[model samples]
Target: MPMAADIFDRARAASRDLEGVTRPAWSSEDQAAADILLGAAQEHGLTTRMDAIGNTYARLAGRDETAPGILSGSHLDSVARGGNFDGLAGAVAAVTALAAIRRAGMVPGCNLTAMGTRCEESVWFGIAYVGARLAVGNMDRAEFDALVRLDSGRSIADHMTDQGLAVDDIWRADGPEIKPANTKAFLELHIEQGPLLMEQDAPLGIATAVRGNLRYGDGVCYGAYQHSAATPRRLRQDTVLAVTELLQRLEALWHEIEDGVDPSAVFTIGKLFTDPANHALTKVPGECHFSLNFGSTEQRSQDRFAAAIAAMTEEIGRRRRVRFVLGDPVGSSPTPLDPGLRAGLLASAQSLAIPATEFATVGHDASIFARAGIPAAVLLVRNDDGSHNPHEKMDLGDFEQGVQVLAATMLDLAAE
Candidate 1:
């Protein structure tokens, strides 16, 4: 097998959880994965370093040390029980590409750095791109310190302290370690979270934009519990029905917008359940808990979707005599990738004769970089199963193709 495959196998072995891999942000498993990447970088004669927030970097020096360099790679942390390849594949491919360039005796004009960022998965800290945001000086230190891990109920600051990181210095530092001033471009090689590439029978894809999302993790519908048989349809406040109707209407609005406004618009109700302890199935459900996520590449579409959700919930709640409380929403704006960089990646794909396409991608670390004013691009490899689960499948060959494109793009940017 290739070096990338070996690294992937080793990472999975070290971080294997009950059904999938679990490399929680700033946890031992997360560090272990970074260590593996660092070791591999060292083996390939690259210098390695870890930032204040535990983001790892492996540098392959170029001819001009002072010139702005090209940064690549992806996050190391995974959602709880997530598949191994979701984020790790990109980091591994980055290191492998740098190694390949070194072996081929190719020297660009600027440095190439493979970055393994932490806490890209929001499941842990409920905040996406923690490491990447900090790297670009976009994070608010106060907000970061206040964030609590979902499972541990511990603040992110406590987690960082426990991991032996200098929590205070992180905020006191002059600026971020990786900034737009020093970085020419950020290229991320990641697996397609959806089945787009696989369905297209293409091995790779270049992202055009990253979708921004509105996420409500704590959405609740409340009503008075009543006897199922005794309560008439007009009298009973059915929380379940109210919530279901809200979602159905929202989905319908999404379809409308997708057809006319933005074809990339998507809506999902990821979680919905009635209170199990309150009553049995015989009783009218009194409460429902759910999560709502709406995403689109256009800000206007997102705004329209948000308005529709609010209107629907208010109308349904008033009619059903229920109450809807959607917790504070959190999300980023849609980020367009660098068109020139994307075109260069496509040119490289064409030159290499790799079947590649261009499409919008879900949020990734590359989005953070692009938002920070650094040119960014995302190269996606084909994956069989969707991401954030154990079934994610990226063929080794497909990953190599992504790496080839990434390396070519990095070289193109570095030489300039």
Candidate 2:
């Protein structure tokens, strides 16, 4: 029997490998992370390969390779200042889960794929979930060509080339090689990253659905800059002020997302910056596109929220007289828990004698595969306060409880 300490030790070791390996955006770090996961998989006797866009696939051959497989893992990339555990934690857990089952002489029901996806953070192209998107055949060349990083002017295609992936290879992710039949279900075990489970005092939360989201960049705003002594506040058109107005309007619209919406319908104004620290610089950046997160179980409710939010952005931009170029709203097809799978997990939780609750996810790798029509479910480990800041931490007790819950769920799934 592997103690909790043993599991944590292995995960902690893997976490160390990914520490400070910040977003390569398009640099070698992305490739490096992929290499690391491939190596890890190889050690476990798992067959592995890297796709054109850096999405790594590792196979755990079951009694039957012809049977549809279940896949799970997190993105290998991180956001700027991303912690070592954010994405890496789930990756370690997936592989660890398989390793533990095998070492325990537990039999697996089907082929399993422990996937480590690339470009989860949009550091290179400002597009989140690139690895999952590529796996699902959502990323196209035209969109890839136009995407750019916040600080760097390099295009996404350029970054792919730098990572040893040709632009055409990225665009042409359409062959039978990248098809979706390999996955029967996608299960991702992740840190709650929020206080919901912990604050609610729930040992484990069954992820019911993932939040739908949209992201687009607005071109830089232009405005006159003048000395405080020379420029009248009333006469000057302030880019930041205009952007502020738009942001506030977005907040107002979000609040209107209906009465029965999920608690996670959040709209965040995450990043904002301006160039030319000098007082003389005019042409202030007008870009103020933030992400829209709509996480709910009901499709109609999500639809209402999206329509209302889109209208809100339009009206606010028009009022401010700033050109608002809207990009494709990353419409997410809602993924629900399989009733039979949920029942199996519920029974597993009962047998393990651990407390369990059901919750919806506003963010997750599980949702991507689930949206792609794979029956998917997420098992969450609790965190305190849900603050993603450096001060963020999780309860050791809850983490242990999570392992039991997860193990029980796995046993139940396999039994079926």
Candidate 3:
């Protein structure tokens, strides 16, 4: 079996571009990444193929072909300008684990399928878990048609056309579906994305749940535009200040709730912009827009946050003399990871003498599988910086340890 560092190095080499890991779903870079995984799978004597929605799977055949296969791996697509380890690490570990199992000459009782999923980041489109949803036959036609990529303005179907898949074939009821019944279990290894594991001085951690989120993808605050020189400070309805006030109040509210209720609750403003095409330096800004992302593991906490936002919006509108129009929230609810799988993962870590902690994650593909009733586990390797950025750093030593835990867990579960 190859060293875990070598596997990561190979993955980085495959996606080494000017823009950090620029393998958005359905892009040439994404296809190349898939091909790289496929090559690795075939080299290990595993049959490989891609499904309609571009989920690449490599299977090590078992004695009982009729038995549900053990599925392991993660998405290969990355957010634009994202770090190489975000989604690619898990897929590499999956193949590496399978290769190690093969090298041990242990033929499993059921098939071990390594997968590299697509569009899990939702950076290109507004939808998350696209590839996994399609694989599990949970995607709807309307939802697929409505998913428009921000950069290309093309629907997911348009991208599917480019990939040579019929739009109608994205979701299936009969064959080719990868659901809980057909898959015995799912396991993924990912970078911690945050400093939790590193701060705790641990090399690996297991996720307890993935936090649910409320998102205003296109939120805006409106006020009348006026000449900056002519308008008095008190009389002018500045949209920038209007938005800022609400954001400030919201942050305060977040702290209050987090301190008093759930400490894990969090919120963020992802994008803030003012129309530059029509604005001038001399003019008071008329409109301001920003994305709102709030999340927590508890449903009631999210409910409270939404209520706070609504109340704050009304107050901001009345005080600033501006209108607050928030876009509809879109996101999945918090999903609990499988306890059985969690225990197994913990046992593997302990047996290997690796210190591990369990925490709630913001979002991840493993959560989707867990929500769909498939037992799932997420192994987080300690990293120096958060994911989805160019400067993201993950320790190669920590990743190797994570791979060891994953491989041990797979062997334990696959043993007859």
Candidate 4:
């Protein structure tokens, strides 16, 4: 059986030509990455198949074929120019661990499936967990119609058609669904994607929950345009000023929430820009655009965020005499990890003497499963340089430790 390092090496080599591990949803590069996983599964003598939505699964049958299976793996899709280990590491870990079990000639009590999901990154279609939702039959036509590619302005249905997927079956729920009835539990092995593990000098961590996030993708601020030299500072409705003040107010709100309400609450302004065609160096800007991303483990914190933003917008609009429009924020609520799976992972780590901590600030496909009432857990490998960057660093030793724990946990679960 190939070790975890070998599995990661093969994945990196296969995707080397793709832009910094970018394999966007329904893109050919994404298919190529999936093909690598398929080939590896086939080589290991596991039964491989692709679903209508393009999710591939490699199954190692258990003593009882009718029993619900343990599903493990993460997305194969990546954000443009993203790091290699962000989503791919989990899939590789699943494959490696399954192969190790096979090599040991240990037959699990229940079916074990290694999956490679598609389109977990929301950057492609403005919707997260597309593949996982589809696999579990959580996607509806209305939600499917709402998914439009940010770059091409094309519907998700178009992308599926382009990829030769059976869109009708996907939409009408014409096939088998990976629900709790047939899925005993879901597990993912992913990189920490932050510096917490490195700071604590640990190689692994077990996630406690996935943070709920609100994203305002098309927030806009409007003000009347005027000559920069002619408009008085107080009289002019400057959009730049309005936006700056709004941001400051939001930052203040962040402090208030975190310090007093919920320390886990976090917020960021990822994108802000003005239309180049409508403005000049001398003209006071008429409009500006920005994005707001805030997340918290507590649902009540999200409610407070909405109230604060509305109050701030009303105040700023009145004082500055400008219109403030925020796009409809779309997001998911926080999902806690399954206690049994989390405890199993912790025990496995402890038995191996691998130091680990608890994390709850990131989102993953595992969260989608958790929200659907399926038992789910995430094991994070310590990584440096953070994630979603070309320079992201994940040490081989750290990755191996995570894989070890994942394998042991799966074995223990299967025996139960």
List, residue by residue over 40-103, the lDDT tens digit for candidate 4.
Answer: 8888878888888999888888888798889899999888888888888898888878887887
lDDT of 2 at 214: 52
Error of 4 at 50 (Å): 2.0
Candidates in order have lDDT scores of 0.89, 0.62, 0.83, 0.85
Candidate 2 lDDT over 1-416, as tens digits, reads 23333434443444333333354455666566566666766776778887777777877667666767777778666665455556665665566556666667766777766777777775556667877776777666676667876677877767777788755665552452334576676767777777687677776777766755554433344454545456565655455766677667666656765344555466665556555454344443434333444455666666776676567556654555555445566555556666666666567677877777877775676666666667777777776645333444556566556555555565455545
* Model 1 stretches with alpha carbons more than 4 Å out: 152-158, 161-164, 222-241, 274-289, 317-322
TM-score, model 1 to reference: 0.90
List TM-score per model, in order.
0.90, 0.70, 0.85, 0.87
Clashes of 1: 0
Ranking by TM-score: 1, 4, 3, 2
Whole-model alpha-carbon lDDT for candidate 1: 0.89
| Cα misplacement distance, residue 147 of candidate 4 (Å) | 5.2
lDDT rank order: 1, 4, 3, 2
lDDT of 4: 0.85
Write model 1 residue lDDT over 144-256, tens digit each, in one string: 87899999999998898888888766655567777777999999999999988878999999999999988898999999899999999999999998999988888888999
